[model samples]
Target: MHETEVVGLNVQRRRRGWPTLDIGPFFMFFGIAGTDHGREARMERRFEQEYFSNAVTLHLASALSPGTYALHGLPEEANKRGWTVGPQGGNPTGHLSADGLDELRGWMRRTPSQRDRRVRPERMLPPA
Candidate 1:
């Protein structure tokens, strides 16, 4: 998986685990050092995943008090008609120190375009 700091990006290395191989199958990842307002301690378990043919991305962001989070992965359906997030959609696999599940479940931000939701007229489209 990919690791990127949304706020302060400190990229130590962004290359194959072993760069010597012309086409190495594995990538490298490093932990970030940051101050979090809060942290939920998941039970803790080994988490590792790798794909020989595709790339994955991850996002990490933290702020004071609380914020909303319902980032989407690729659309789950082959048709890509329905877009959703959280544990029910394009699920993220791994074990965390604390589930923070309730908090997570509470922040499934939805756009008006989602099913059953209507988009009100806006001033104008932001940009292309």
Candidate 2:
């Protein structure tokens, strides 16, 4: 997935989508606990240097969005009630799925323009 894709998802949806995410390997400086010069302060700087030192954090975050350190995806099909509140109850909560493995029951109900890439999915939503 990409940053624009992640930008389209809410916190709940993001959590539902990437349930097994782990930050330990995405960045080399991860797990910086218990250091000599205050791990909190050093970790803060490490975050800045790793992500904001360049505008590439967008790509980094996006790439990290779809990963996991262990098992991936839901354990069963019946666990998808979380997507019921989405714009289209049948529409999958995933943004960039090629096959829409996470798509819900009414996937075909929405018009093609509603899924157009010319406009972002989140941009189509009503104001929160």
For 78-99, candidate 1 gives per-residue lDDT tens digits of: 1111212244332222211112
> What is the C-alpha local distance difference test score of candidate 2?
0.28
Residues 34-90, candidate 2: write the lDDT tens digits.
424465675665553433221101111122222111112222231212222233232
Best lDDT among the predictions, by candidate number: 2
In angstroms, give how far residue 27 of model 1 lies from its true place.
Answer: 45
How does each model score on TM-score? 0.16, 0.16
Q: Each model's C-alpha lDDT?
A: 0.24, 0.28
- Could you tell me the lDDT of residue 122 within candidate 1? 12
In the order shown, the candidates' Cα RMSDs to the true structure are: 18.6, 16.3
Backbone clash pairs for candidate 2 read: 90-106
Off by over 4 Å in 1: 1-91, 97-99, 109-128
